[model samples]
Target: MRVTGLASGIDIDEQVKKMMAAKRVPMDKMSQNKQLLEWRRESYRELNSAIADFRYNKLDKFRLANATNVFSSTVTGNKTAVTAEATLTANQVDMKVRVEKLATQTTATSPALADSTTSKTKLSELGAVGNADGKVILEVSRGTGTPIKLEFSKDDTIQSVLSKINANTDAKLNASFDEASKKLIIKSKDYGADPFTLNGEFDTGIMKTKTPEGNLQIGEPAKVFINGKEHNPAQNEMTINGVKLAFLEESGNEESVITTRPDGNNLIGTIKNFVASYNNLINTLNSKVGEQKYKDFPPLTSEQREKMNEDDIKKWEAKAKSGTLKNDGIINGALLQMRSLLWDTSTKVGNKNLDLSSIGITTGEYTEKGKLYIDEEKLQQAINNNPDEIAAMFGGTKEKDGLFQRMYDRLLTPLTSISNKAGTSRYSADPTLSFNEQSIMGKELTDLNSRMAAFSKKLKTTEDSFYRQFNAMERAINKFNMQSASLANFAGQ
Candidate 1:
């Protein structure tokens, strides 16, 4: 315990506290600087997240031909027999579809039991004889592949056998027991014409496979005719010429006609969304770079925060966080590149040079900072006149000269630069994941932390020294007072 101010009547403890507070000024500044750096890193990460969302979700899809050239199909005649869907590459022509046969799965059933039994009934009770070791082995085969062998004790219940068969994915089989029919039924999980066989002691005892035809039924492939050309697919669905056709039922002699047409609404909506998202992203970047910094407001120290209410702290922090990304070179450079790319006239749609202006998309006033403005009526006219050109302009051909491709490629530069500086993970979808400590900003934080630690140690030593000096001074004053009292007593004697 410290006993001060008793001898000299000077509040040494308070004086020492005041001295330490002044000594801590540099430490508080370091704290504020560290906090500011953290805020800037957070801001960069937020921008990275926004850019990733735009690149992956919007630009990736918009650059695809399918997204810009959406197609819808309609079935006219025998619609119930077949359904069709068309892709961007599909030919806009009518196709006749006739489904002669629907696909079926291979199935097998055991002969009725001598007595009614539930799944819980023991196999032995159902007359299932086991081997000498009292174990029944069931071998199941699908197609010409190797058979799956399942062994169970005769004492096991029928449910156990069914569960084992159903759980074996490699078997590709499903097994069940019917209580009312007193029979065991099994079938291939896949729809195909492939042969399925069951051969084992259990089959003889429970499945009664002695007369194979009476117990087993083979599956049939789906027989369909597209434009009078026959196709025998193992499944009911087939894709031809980029058009997917799914056979619902046999049409006998009747034929269903599938017609394809361009879907304008979907294409227009996609373009509109792209424009809106582009504007939103650029606006956010612009605001961040142009935001005003409050020079008077620095990050609060712990001591300062302790003295203020929550509302006051929040308002102060708002000013402190403003313009963390002001005039960032990487962000400003990206904005300029994006604006230039959109205005590039070198992109060609066929023989004609195509640009955003050709499709009613143009930049707003200079004050808007490259925000896009779309003329809807003119855009609709352009789409109506030559939708293929519009699709090629946005999605491009194999040449990759389209606007979406250009924008997507341009975005990569900034994204990479930001990730390198801010330590944001480029591969991960999550922005809040731990920063890479080797990044530029991360290294800066590491240095700050090291310096702060060293300074803190030094501050500790200084505080201890101040307390020791005060203690010595107090002792000296106490000794002097004791000597004065002794002299007065001697003189009186």
Candidate 2:
């Protein structure tokens, strides 16, 4: 409906080309904005993940010696089972214990194939001598002795088959069933005892059989020793080495407290964490910066336009991009550190020999924010220079100020405090709004975290979509530009 770029007397091709050129800018703008949003979202994810990791790392591990309410495995009939501990530690004392037991097992056998040739047939075509609803009589032959007759009922299931077989047999042959394959098979007590067979015909058309798989026993209860001291073992309580621990089966139960073991090097984790995190951020950003628009779609939703605007999206994109010539000391220092090698050359390299630079981490040019990139080279240097620092940067290697540490302090402290509060009871027909300082603050922090996460995700998706659209627009514009020039040439001719 609108016509402005092309002259009124211009060729129709020229007009089309002009229209395309005009559309290009808006599409590009949309793509750029979308990419910015994606980056922001990814940043948010990295930040949140760091925070969660920090909080969990703060929880120190303890041995089963510190566990509570440990029960005895002997209560059910386990003799070899020793006292188990819930915590991971080196000392222990008196503690309660419990026995772990399982239900009894049963077994049943099927009639042997009369042909002895050992041919297989479909269940539908299988010859029958047993009824579907009644018990079937099967003759079990071990060696050359008179065969033992065993009766199996329809009520018997695969789980109970083993117990049933043991009850009826002193012979060496074992009877088993496979539920999954639906086949009846027999095995000899000793190896190479071939030709052990069962003789019985299925009376009903359904001659299908089943086999069962075996499972290992659950480990004995863990031990618990509290405060470098000893305590009686109770259910879920244990003393491992010398740490006190308890395994509360229920969620949010104060009684179910268990100490965790500490992994050395929090700082390294902090830094490398950002690597994975930043990669995710890049993915989100790429999507937004070049997304395609749904031509027929409506304008932005009300919520979409509220927190983020077109301009805000642009600003974020600018921040994400580094100028080719510009540099920041913090980012640069991090990069320089990454490039340097810390460990000496050694043929006997293990976890200690593992340097940061060995990986593809280096510094390079980043156009989006005009900042130096930690490309393969710089990345490796940074990792090699001080692997611990790099890891700590990403919330690894266990530092208090790492990304995860900050995130955890910012997000979880208030939440836990509020959740722990014992609030006053309010009695009213309509719920009275009595806001506790701790509760309110906790809720606020939680809300902020949720909002930030959602916003980041939305922004990333939008930007990614925008970039795709932008690429399409660029192609269209290029095509139109060529067409416009071609038209002018044609008109001249």
Candidate 3:
């Protein structure tokens, strides 16, 4: 703010700028440190995300498969008529089922009504056209329960009155008028005994409402014979001991045989996916932990960047960002632990090939780090020939755990550790920004920021003092020149 050297003929502004530039060196260095810290934080966060994905998305599925054991169900007989499914407990379960009856809901229809008794017709017109009672009563019940009664009467149109009934009626019955059928149709919500029994005194003479012989649908539950035992239910679907059966249609002639077999292909897919995911995660971790660091490539200062083109700056930053996570003990230690897990012996349950190698999952060359490679043919052959053995490896013995369970536990350890160190956005306790905090690096960044802030404040104060001193010098210089000029003028006169 101090203009320099109007009378002293010295460009004080330029000189002051040169002096302040020196003073700015410390602040600029702190800024560069902050930028480097930002890069380091970004690296840690990316690693954390990768680790979480590997553990939660990949390991979690295999862990579930190991715990429960994998199995799939298929129906062979009359598949078009009846499809069946099974869960893990239903492994190797085969059964013959006959669907005797499919549950159906009840429906009742009122006889043809006068032309004026449509949805748009007035509600009060019911008294004039139908019965003078002007009351539309419906009685409904489900199963063998007590009957629920409802009555509706409004000064609105017939459609409005019906909507009110449909909306408010506890009977769970839907009421509507079909113009094509020329009848008021009322259908039960679901199938069950005593589902619906509607007896109302509408002017039967004016609007003769009666059930068409076959139209009267008494609610009926599903009936099926499983293994030659008749089972009746109020629903069409049921799950018994992991075997889920749904009665699609009534089968009167031949019984449908549903067989539940072990799905080796699906299990193979699951295992393959697990292997691929492990490889991808390990490769990334190894690369990052071993990434080369270029110490010469310090973060660029604004002044240094001003001397170079954008492309050069970008190239410089690439080296600067490298090795942010290189040789990090936390990450490297975790990788070592995970790698060791691949070589460890799996559970020795039921005299099975308990090692990952026995199942066609093996690590690549040592140079590839701990990346796993799967032999599809060998894995499938094992699954087909030694299904029980495969099951035993995933599904542990009565005493010990299985291979997948072991891996899950191992992955969980490092995952939890990394999470605690470089937490997810939601869980980070000390974030880099003072406004945000995460566990480890966040605290460091926060302290660094505090120091830089204090230093910046001091720099500002020093710069202000410099300007003030320069301003005073300029004033004195200007006053001395004016006095000298006056003396010269008096001497010449």
Candidate 4:
């Protein structure tokens, strides 16, 4: 058995609840307005998204879908060779005069012992060179020892040439080679011979070097036009319509820096849009759930009035202050994702682990009372580190969720359900009718329109009765006043 919630003629809880409910009409209206604002925000977000997509795909012709292949290498030995794939826009390119060897080469080694002043050995004797197809025929000089004569078949590799030279002579000669760079320079076995000589010759791939080796290998530099301007990474420079960009090698994990200042104001536009959208959402939530100035409580509804109790109000207030709603799961989740993304990876150039907070996003403890807020400087730092990551955090499909979808469900679903149930139209009586009571397959519109006309007529009748009652009361008051004055005159007579 259950007791009635009412007590005597006045239920304190009910009366207080009625006051609360009366106060809450404003909240209900506020909720609708919030929904309207959210709808507007959504419209703007969609429009911006569409515009961005258009710019990236059609308008902004400078976007990079992919990057050109880059080549990097180093040569270790005196004679080295390197081969890599190449692609060029020009059908025919001038691939000559570019030296195959690196412009600058460096080597590090332990210092020679002080007691032993003997110089390190250097290789000197060099001869016969071959091309891509193996063929050997060349001349050599006997500088260190007796001049030696050697003969080898065309099928022999470059390695074979070195083997024959080492076997036939004791001139303190040594040879080492790297296959990557295709460089075959020789040195003397003695350290004092700073520059060893290679007097060799060959046909096809083999070219004679002017200094000592018969021929040096050189190729043309690769060139490209990016955004209608020439760019050569090997040259470490790019010229975009007379605006030159000198790219220094990336230091540490920092990205190679580039500048396009006057035209780079797009960042400002993007940030403004984000702020507008986020503020719109925040404002909507505030309007709906803000505390009342008079009682320091949020407005309640009719159903809430019926159920209000001291204990219940306290509990519900506690829930509002302490639970997910107060903390705002959507906002908290968005921020968390952003923070997680900022700290996810290391710098590309250097293996330095990073976090948003490191760059500037400083996050503190979050609570249900909406105390947590974004640190703009820290957020900007994180964005500077990785713009793509930040964008994805706010609007990515990784989780298949967003604030719009979540908030819409939370605030709209219950109201929609109530609206459907409270509808007095015949459309609501149909079991097959959807909760919204609007569909091509349903007769809901016809029923609702007819019901609305009847309700309007009844409202007019009630208004007319109120006016007639007011007129009647006015006439009675006037008649009583006139009769009172007549009685006073007769008494005086």
Candidate 5:
């Protein structure tokens, strides 16, 4: 602390502080500009996130065939014999179905063992023969796949063997021990006519079973009759004309009938959900573009913030950040493109040109700015009269034509533009990774940072110069006072 102002009778520290404040004006403005740029970048990222949610979650799925076609089926007569499920493209017809037989799995059971037998019983206790190393190996094979060899010591328990068998992926067999009956049962994991074989000493010695040619109980395939024509499948389930039928039991002489039809309520609900999401997204974008800007509310400087309360600072920033994305060219372009796609009627449903208005969807008033409104009654009538046409309209048979597909395709351009301007990492889901620094806004921020740093260094040098000048003036005044005092004393003397 250079104690100045005493010699010159002037407050040197206060004067220098005033001058420095004036010199810092440019630096303060730079800081404010940088803050505004950061806020704008944040706003762009938020908007990108919202658009992505709508595109991937709603539009992407709505353009698929199964999503647009909503249909259901009901089974009448002998419901216990079979159950049916229908997809969107299922034909609306009543078909007679008879389940002649249900599929079964291949299984084998060993004879009753000693009363003391348990899952933990050792292989030696079960009188199993082993190799010279006392390792009892079992070979199990299913279908035409390579056999799985399970090796166990004679001291190994029955539970251990069963666990090894169940854990083997190649064997695909389920092994269990019935403690009550004192019998070991092996069954194939899949239900089919194909047979699995069990070989090796563990099977012959402990199980006391004959060779694979005589001992196995093979599985049987299911037999069913649809419209007086027989169909045999390895499994009990079959799908015909988009209708999946699962046979649960055999129908002796009775036949079950499956009926399918269009579900208007479900289709309406799906469309309503889509409409809600679209409106929500567009509403947010519109609000952002129309948000009012407060020119007087520039970002506060650090020194300014120190003098104000937290609440006041927050309120000030709210106004300052309001118009970061207002009237943005990219966002406005996206909105126009989306509205145009919705209004276009170039695609056709059957022989008639397909349009939102034809199926009860229409835009709101001009002031509302492309908001969609649906007439539910008219939509239901359209669905009931020509459901296929409605499906084709939303989910086009070919790509690039349907309403959802067109919207999805059009959104890519604006999304890409925003991403390029704001910058985004490929791993967007990972919050730890920041936005790419090579983007347009990123490069501008970098340049601004460099300029601010250079200006700050210049300001520091200027402040030091002012302090040096003030000290020099104080030293000169002190020397002059000393000389005057000495001269006056000599004269008086």
Candidate 6:
């Protein structure tokens, strides 16, 4: 610690501050550069997010082309007996359906056993006395699946045997014996054509003693005839000519007439929604491209910001960040390309006359910056007259992509270029991006920061060395003045 001045009588600390202020100019510039890079990076990512929103949320949905959600069908003739659903590939169909027989499951009931509440009352006690080689093996199977077997002996209790069967069947079937009725009941797990069967062997004594035998019940397939054609569906449901038919019961001679046709109302709604989404995104992108840059408002230095209050600093930053992406080549280029694509035509999906204009979609005036506006009446006409063409316009082939696909492709190149320059949130996990080590601006910022840190360290050293030199100079001056004063006193004496 050295005194500021004893003989020099000057504030060395204040002077050092002024000298360092001059030295910090380059450091402040580096800091400003870093901030500007951060702002530019943020701008690129924001634009990318908007692009992604349009591509995934809006464009990807064109795969269906509003057939499932829009242009739905309503069947009037067979409302209760036969129902139908509309799909993307659904064509108009009207047919007669007659269901002759519905499918049914198999069931079997065992003989009653009269016994007391004792484990000693086994299958042998229940009139099923088995010989030495008399073991009852029950195998239950469904369809082509391997049969599951449950084996029992004459010594086994009826309750124990029933518990084993219940535990082993999984969910395929149920086996239960009522306590009051003393009758063992077995039933199939499912209905329809599946043959739910019970084929197993029983001892002679049990087979002879039981009243209503434990023979297996056979299952039956559903008999359905649609439009005079026999449809023996394994299950009760069948899909034919884009219409699903489910059998509720035997309809006998009562014929169900089903009619399917495209409804235009739903198709128009989704088209309008698409147009509005496109307009919103295009307007935002156009405004960004045309946004004016405030060149006079350079980034604030740390020292300069410290002199101002928080609100003033915030205000200054807002102005400083006004046009980070304005006139940027990648972003503006992407905008122009997307706008051009919106005007372009594709032949892969919609052939000739499949352009947006054919379906009543058109661009706005010159001042509107390529915003799409739909003609509702014309759009409805196109939907009603030929919705297939409209669908093809939205969902085109890969080689000659449709309207949405073309727009989506247009943004991909520019988005990639911008991402390479500024990086993205996906790159935040990368050490090179997070530490500003690899990307275009990131590498530049990293070098600037390194130089600033070194410069700051040199400044600190220069400041300390200057303060020590000034202190030494002050001591030398004070000693010389003392010598001069002593000589003057001696001369006067």
In candidate 6, what are the lDDT values of residues 47-128, reduced to their tens digit? 7667767766776674454422333545554456556665546666666787787776666665555545343457767666
Answer with 1 or 2, whichever has the higher lDDT.
Answer: 1
Backbone-clash count (model 3): 9
Q: For residues 89-197, could you state the per-residue lDDT of candidate 5 as single tens digits? A: 6888778999888988888778888999988899999899898878898888766787888898899899998998899887888989988988898888878777877
- Give per-residue lDDT, candidate 2, residue 145: 87
lDDT of each residue in 103-162, candidate 3, tens digit only: 777777666666655678764565533235665655554557776665555356667756
Worst 10 residues of 1 by lDDT: 345-354
Q: State the C-alpha lDDT per candidate.
A: 0.84, 0.38, 0.70, 0.36, 0.83, 0.68
TM-score of 2: 0.23
lDDT of 1 by residue, 21-48 (tens): 9999999999999999999999999888
Q: Give the per-residue lDDT digits (tens) of candidate 4, residues 321-377.
A: 322123333334433443343345223224654443454433345433222245555
- The segments of candidate 1 whose C-alpha lies over 4 angstroms from its true place after superposition are 56-69, 112-125, 131-135, 142-145, 148-169, 174-185, 189-192, 209-214, 333-348, 380-389, 392-416, 429-432
Q: Give the residue spans of candidate 5 off by over 4 A.
A: 1-3, 108-145, 148-189, 200-215, 345-351, 398-401, 425-433, 488-493
Runs off by more than 4 Å, candidate 4: 1-273, 291-377, 380-493
lDDT of 4: 0.36
lDDT of 2 by residue, 1-493 (tens): 4332232333444545455554444444454444443333333233333333333433111111111112121111222233333222222234332323211112233434334222233222334345554555556565688987766554444334445555664545455555444545445444321334445543222222322231211123223333334343433434454443343322221112222322222322323444454444333333333344333332343334577878965554354442311332322332233223112211113455433334343333554322212345554454445444444433332223433334333445322322233121121111233434344333444555565566556655665555445555656766888899999999999
Query: Model 3 — TM-score against the truth?
Result: 0.75
Report model 4's TM-score to 2 decimal places: 0.23
